[model samples]
Target: EIIAAIEGLMKDPAVGHPLKGKRVLVTSGPTREPIDPVRYISNHSSGKQGHAIAKAAAEAGAEVTLVTGPVSLADPVGVTVVHVESARDMLAAVEAALPADIAVFAAAVADWRVASVADNKLKKGAGGPPSLAFVENPDILATIAKHGSKRPQLVVGFAAETEAVVDNARAKLARKGCDLIVANDVAPGTGTFGGDANTVHLVTPDSVETWDRQSKDGVARALVTRLAEMIAKA
Candidate 1:
């Protein structure tokens, strides 16, 4: 049964071969930064985009590992899935799954975490209010981009911007030291979160490719095809 599934994936036309025999790692969902045992900070990411990418990469004949944050989503077939909670945990999981040909940081990792987490949940009336201290979380994309060994040949990051989408994406591509950055606007009414469709700009070192808004599946397929071409040319 496993062999048949593998063969079926290999023969899928919507998939590509530039990534054949390669390994890909993808990070997805919103990382939780705990303030207390019962409270944490998180975002609204639904994990659809990253899951789609994982599925597409696997269908393209690549060994895909998805290091994901807590999300109520089903695992993509043919992809290895690792579940994590906090931003720090997600970073650790991605590092452990490394040495891939491609790494895509699609997770909306919280930039900051509580400096100290309370062992127990804070209760009202103990104090007027509880104060929280914050510290920066590790930049997983940058870390992988600059890994000492087995650094992926291609690194991709996502810029979920509410304004200045293209500009921010371009800056992130440079700042994160990734080969490409996909920028998308999450403005009100954009329907980026918990939506099946997306429109994004692919920012590279020298060019920006704007893709028409389409279903997440369509975007995933296109990205896999592009990755295949890049691997073939590399």
Candidate 2:
């Protein structure tokens, strides 16, 4: 952390815009799957990490487009923000923000949504609980990553897991066909869902690099740096 702080302080502001001519797309927060007008199925993602990445990208001079779900945080200055609710809505917004030089999938989109939505709020009744039919939501990460020509040059993904963090991320890296997977543990008590910091492992096809715990903003800045290097190498 000390070294990271020193590196950050040492970075020359004049050379900050390494991605000056680049375009970036980032997704944040958890998509809500509505069960009724008053109830929904969603995770605990806070959009902190995603928002930080979008902000860092803009600071690097990239033309950034942020597609986010319901979050209380203010929109990042200089970023084009697209607000979405359900997973399907998020998918549409993401598809619309295309042709990015780099794409980051940071949102914890719901895997399934209620097949049939209730028109009004559900109330207590003799029937203990109402049965719900769920259907798979669109695979946004894989869809964008597999897009032939419209696919971004660099695709990044995130894996929030309770166990086998690196292993799961490695599998996801192949399954989703993304260039990188930022893996972290979001199991109960990790405070990752709404926390300010993260400890992540950068998983790729060839290797895994574990980074020390740091602020979400710090991870974003460091990620942007790595992305610049990756794109340059490509």
Candidate 3:
């Protein structure tokens, strides 16, 4: 059955996984930054791409560890999933499952979290709304990319931007210190958020390669295949 599945996947070119003996780590979904016990801030990440990558990695015969934020999807088969809510929690989870061959950061983590969260929900005052302060969240991709010894052989980050998609992605690639950045525009009404399809540009220090529009699963397979080749050459 497994051989049949692999042969079927190989025929597609975009859906074959060849990552045997590799250890892959993936982060997915939207991280919620809590403001109070009842309120929080988050984005609209659905985790489709990240989850698909994890599934593809497992299919490629890799041992996968998926560190994900809050989402409503079932866990992928043959992947070890670690559930987390906040950006801090996600970072801690990723750190705990380190020494991986590859790391993919696909989570739309909140850039800032409330400086101080109230123990209870803040009540609406008669005078005005409650004021909230924010602080920067941990830079998980950059952190792992810059790790001294425990760093993965390949570190990939996702950049969801509205303007200057490729340029911004290139900037993020340099800024995050990751090996590659998978960038896509998530402008309103683009269907990139919570959508199955994607148009991505693989940004690396050497070049930016744009891919044709395709399903997230196809993208995952192609990416895994590329990473496997790179690891083999390394």
lDDT (tens digit, per residue) of candidate 2 on 105-166: 99999999999999999898998889999999999999999999999999999999999999
Question: What is each predicted model's overall lDDT from 0 to 1?
Answer: 0.90, 0.95, 0.93
Query: What residue pairs are clashing in model 3?
Result: none
lDDT of 3 by residue, 54-150 (tens): 9989998899999999998999999999999999999999999999999999999988999999999888889799778889999999999999899
TM-scores for candidates 1 onward, in order: 0.92, 0.93, 0.92
TM-score result, candidate 2: 0.93
Model 1 ranges off by over 4 Å = 1-16
Span of 10 residues, lowest total lDDT, candidate 2? 9-18
Between prediction 2 and prediction 3, the one with superior TM-score is 2
Angstrom error of the Cα, residue 24, model 1: value is: 0.6
What value of lDDT does candidate 2 attain over all alpha carbons?
0.95
lDDT of 1: 0.90
